[model samples]
Target: MATNQDKNHPQLKFETKNNTVNKLITVAYFITIKYNPDHFLTMFKKLYNKDQLYLIYIDHTCSIEVKNMIQTYIVHLSNVYILDSFYLQTDSHNKYKIQLNAMQYLLNVSAKWDYYINLTDDHYPLKSQYRICEYLSNNKEHNYFIYYDKSRYDLDTYNSNKYNYSGLIALKEATFSESRIIPYMSNTWLILTRDSCAFLSYSKQVDHYIELYSKSLLPSNSFFATILLNSDYKRIIINHDQRILFSKSEPIELILKKIKSNNHFFIRKMNLTSNSIIDKCIEDNYQLPLMDKKENKNELGLNNNQQN
Candidate 1:
């Protein structure tokens, strides 16, 4: 049933689960992978449940045969709804646009879910889904979050930052730009409320801002966190955003100790390809690193999507 996307599936609208009213946690996985269609699915299946809704988007860069194979497999599953058209997120020239596009697709498809998780094809949750579901069902007051401030680390000058693409102009803009800019950082992976989901729904100015900044930028995800924290949201608390590093170049044990030193909740930007990353995260026993979020929450519950 899979035709060339441009041939017959030109107008692509991936269908989500038919209904969603009782599920405790709904995770939207918008992913673009380099190879092996099942590379994404294999990771997803280990952490997800039949009750949790999945709206999958594949890239057209893959062979139609491969695309068909993935689509056929996903559609047959009850909870995993198959999206027909595969878009290209691999082309370097359009990476930013396609990444955002994938996210938008996931958001629209997930219009009927509760919790929304944005993850890379490589991200896999280490925590037990049941444990997560139980915790979320019981505690409904906080926002899941993570943040880093290059400004706080004496690197506000920009030229010294890791990628060095951002510089004095960016710093001045964040400090005194008419936009009243501020800088925040995160690992790009996140689990957020439907409220946060709707809040992140792209607006003209927001998208414009993103387009302006994301061009030629190396770490778009880091900038996104800065934008969100500076926004009206207040419930965000610092959760660990580092996947425990096993690269001997950086000590994983020391980093875990540093993370636990702060008591943060979640971590990200992990080599989810590795079995050890999941094992390391679980070894922490759910004792997360964290920071106070009181200064951040505000009139941010935009009342955006009402009847999902």
Candidate 2:
């Protein structure tokens, strides 16, 4: 029963034995596609499990047959959602809508899950499922993870030259809203806790501004960053939300080397066409501290709950 994974030993049990389960994470994939997947589905099937609720959305142009076919393939999945009947995402620079389209699905679809992740179609993990989960479990008590330089002024102070831009936006019919900022941010692969998810899932005020702004062209990065700064929320953490930018293959071994030290859960922006890149990363002698499935939800905080 012990196979290559065991042979490689992605994670050492003794290393993770002391870690505790942190928070409950719901990994939701908002895949928007023009064509039904042939090869990528197989990769997704391998990478994903019943634990993740894959919320896939077709761009309205895809045929019904393809939708159902994909639906049938992903067992234990009713999390898939079709986009607005009239919405057409192709050729439109509507990253706001694209973001909101996915959000709408998550908000209306499943309410029980916590720590939902927003990933794109091109995104793929460089680590095994088991590896990521374990690390999260270890950090459960810490609500805040990002390290900000103490020299910087308070984030809410607009004069805090550390940032480029920030703002809020709506998701749907005056129903939901998300505040975001830019410049200081990278791509939006935020691993939000349950409380944060709840606020995003059910806020009408935030939704109104986002809806108006989504209709125009603004900075995606700034929008979320702005949201983080303005909100009553205690702290905002930022890093490479997208794991590794999947432009073209450089050195799979080198990439894995970085991920291990980073301690962040996911790396992404993959060339979906190339399966070999991932295979090589997995096969590489290079090791990452792969966390267990039960561990992805944990974080620790020294003074997290104490209001400063």
Candidate 3:
């Protein structure tokens, strides 16, 4: 079991505001990146907040140059940490282990954060940090992720022998005989509460499931949802992950349209090619000086009217 540490870590210190409305809801972000350090840096700058914690994992497959580049960029930021000891191919069940490690590290690092969010290098924030924190503060009790029972399509794909897997069959058989726990699937993206994160990080049941799913195909996709849904945490589960998924084949215009129509906080699979769209999203959602200037202008008008 992971022990909760004091809010003030000797290495880092964050200020707590007295005003509830102005208080920032701190988030611990677990980020996994393999390639494209440039794109990762861009997203990192946008998401960086002194109050939040970022634990970044660079895949072992990446070159040393890539690793150094990332390390150099975030070296000065106390809140940002690179998980230099962890090296895993994120395409497999190792992704699940990486997240577990991050959860434990985050728990030990500080007790001040309210939520944990996992992201990848391909992801970009649809809203500013302030906006995301505000929304999370308002919806503190809810956990966000998309989950459902195994679909026929998924079963067919797994059973088709497209990938080598004796583990999936064994897991299904074991679950069938047990009748207490069943398999569940979901996307890797999640916004989990600190309590839920603690449960996942330290539970012995989670350790058992880790052993069971170690050889299963795409364990990262199934592991988190299966545990949360089958546990008491299910009561706080919300089906939406608050993220927009995009494909490289999709038209930029259509992608922008979808982003505009949706209230999602983040979007994934973004690359340098989509810089224009990313810029547009930032312009619209980021709490920039332009936005503050506009608000100030409006406030001045209100003040004049009140004086009159």
Candidate 4:
């Protein structure tokens, strides 16, 4: 159902201070959703751009009606795709595998993007797409993820399971290996460069660690950081994911205050109602004046307000 117009949509570009023109950094985003189809669609609409790519994985356990609804709604979007291959269980290791599979699928779909971002249904962007692209364009070489050395935590009795593997043993089995890759834990969210994405998607060492971590508890927390930290990509890694974690029970007004005070690009655990409010807040704070808007319109030859 994709149209020629969708395929030929104008790419986003910005001019540098030295008067050179450069393409705005394009992002490939993969989102995993399990429930609340309507909420997911709303988030998708807010984040969608024809110039970028989106791959959605709906948990197979989700109802058929919910899955069909999401599919039918995004059917015409050329840049949006749904992963329909296999069921993803709630197991921790399965989540790690799903991320790896999604990254590989994205590499097969397009190699033009500059970055890869993974999100869940509860996440929402705090900054506009233009702002995100602009920031990334400025900092293209760095990868963003928050990581901690495994030695920092006392894993003695943590999330123990019937496998009877001691926490230390599980950590070793999950991350450490004969290659001497030091184990690290990280938040699941990440912002990785295209090269890092390719490395994680196709590298042999990454595959080895994937197999090594197959049975480890909460491998998703360690797999990516471990791989990147032990590789040459470690030099470009930035320890911040640029996301604000918010509790659903928190007041929206306080959340708005925190958002205005901080420079995070996204927030998580937001419901639809709170998301709408935050969206308005971003618009008000970042809205350009009429003269600037006119100049941008002339330069880009497209309405900045247009959404997919």
Segments in model 1 whose C-alpha atoms lie over 4 Å from true places:
1-23, 35-38, 59-66, 82-103, 153-176, 202-205, 214-216, 233-237, 242-308
**Tens digit of per-residue lDDT, candidate 1, span 1-308:** 21233333333233223222244555554455445555566566555555566655566677777776667555445555554444544543354455455456556655655665545455544444554555556545445556656556554333123455444445434433565555555555555666655555674445654644543233454545555555655444335332333344566666556454433333434454555654565556543323333333333324542110
Q: Over the stretch 1-308, how does candidate 3's per-residue lDDT look in tens digits?
A: 11234344333222222212348688899888875667887787767766688888888888889877776666656677767545557775677788888898889888888899999888887766776777777766677887766633345213213264433353455443465665766778889889889989998878878766755666777889778766543336667787878877877687777666546778877664647755666566544211111111111123233110
List residue ranges in candidate 2 displaced over 4 A.
Answer: 1-24, 34-36, 63-65, 75-86, 90-93, 140-185, 211-215, 249-253, 259-269, 272-278, 283-308
Q: Which stretches of candidate 3 lie over 4 Å from their true place?
A: 1-21, 151-171, 233-235, 251-253, 275-278, 287-308
User: What's each prediction's TM-score?
Assistant: 0.62, 0.60, 0.78, 0.78
Give all candidate RMSDs, comma-separated: 8.6, 10.8, 11.7, 10.4
lDDT (CA) for every model shown? 0.49, 0.46, 0.68, 0.68
Q: Indicate the residue-level lDDT of 182 in model 3.
A: 59
Clashing pairs in 4: none
Question: Candidate 2: minimum summed lDDT over ten consecutive residues — where?
Answer: 293-302
Better of 1 and 2 by lDDT: 1
Instruction: Provide the lDDT at 104 for model 4.
Output: 84
- Candidate 4, after superposition: displacement of residue 244 in Å? 1.4
Worst 10 residues of 4 by lDDT: 292-301
Q: Please identify which of the two predictions, 1 or 4, would achieve the higher TM-score against the true structure.
A: 4
